[model samples]
Target: MAADGPGKKKHGVLFDVDGTLIDSSYFHAMAWWQAFRREGLDIEMSAIHRRVGMGGDKLIQSLVPDCTEDMQEELKAGHSAVFSTFWPSLRTFDSVRDLLAACSDAGLAVGLASSAQERDLEVSRHLLDAASSIDAWTSSNDAKESKPAPDILEACLEKLGLGPEDVVFVGDAVWDVKAGAAIGVPVIALTCGGISEAELRDAGAAEVYDNPRHLLEHLESSMIGKLMTGSLDA
Candidate 1:
């Protein structure tokens, strides 16, 4: 979901939904866990968490490199099956609403660029009650590839009618950073999704924050960093 409001419009901001803006990261891990179990594979939660931002196809392959392509599909299907059953339990992070509000209040267009399915993205919008603050959003369903590829971010930019120079992307995973870099958007790495600050930086994140609250606290400085620090925003 993207929120729209009347305000200044010099720039736009894109957000990653699962770990960056909401608390669904851990649930996604569990969903993947249940999905793998259904396929008779036992994997560690830590391993699953590390691959949380990857698309379903890559995710299954990352966990079980030896699995055949057909098995990968079955595993992905199983994971989705298990995850859908647990959707009712999902919740938004506490800082999400404030973060979006702050961005909009600061005269930035806010958008959601998540790798989650369209249905899951809708669930996030419903859970966060964030229909108004996000100006645009793009889901995995809208792209040919997911994170680590520029497709999702590209889709969001096209939908929002903004150039890469006019947007700043925020996310919680290394894949997010890679995707942002691939598209030439400056990325702010948020630690709320369980990725380390160093990892985010190495992945090409321009700045790293502990969570949305911290990012909001440093918005002017951080957002400015994105706008001018030798990237698309420049």
Candidate 2:
């Protein structure tokens, strides 16, 4: 990991890509479901949905604990192939670009702490059309572990030259909440990923919103705003 530069911002914000910025949670779940079917497993979509934010290896292991290493690799490949077919239909939530720009304009370094593959992150960035506002981003390859482990968040922080206390995370799943918590970063959870406000709150989210538009609408009062103004405590 790289060290912070003298001119680096004091505060930053990290965002999870799949369900938080892009509306692809269900697509991921379906792809996993298809992959499981190919391997003669019959897991429910609801179960898969709940695990969407985890890395592919972890997701496969969690869903199929008895799966061999070889089988896990195959399942992961199957999911990637299936998920690629849905790329064209993926869409970003309302005001995602504006929300990112708002954080950047507030002088907050914006980093994407996604557990997505490089190709998938590229597609999401293309759809967001707000690359100029992003100071840094992390793909699965950037970390040895994924969400619920804090590795990806740590990687993003390194990339942005920020610390956990200097930033907040925005995500759409319990795994994301857990990941942020592990690193002492407060998470602002969104229900746009199909998770409930109650579940997100229970999972340790600092605040809950309906989607990116809702957060953007309340930007001045949100955690991102607090971080920017140095009003939020470390």
Number of the predicted model whose lDDT against the real structure is largest: 2
- For candidate 2, give the lDDT of residue 171: 96
Candidate 2 Cα outliers beyond 4 Å, as residue runs = 1-7
User: What are the candidates' C-alpha RMSDs?
Assistant: 2.9, 2.0
lDDT of 1 by residue, 99-154 (tens): 78877665667778877887888888888787678778877778897668889898
| lDDT computed for candidate 1 | 0.80
Candidate 2, residues 1-234, lDDT tens digits: the string is: 222331558898899999999999999999999999999999999999999999888898898999999999989899999999999999999899999998888888888888799998889989998877888888888999877899999998888878888899999999999999997999999999999999999999999999999999988898888887899977
Clash pairs detected, candidate 2: none
Cα lDDT computed for each candidate against the true fold: 0.80, 0.90
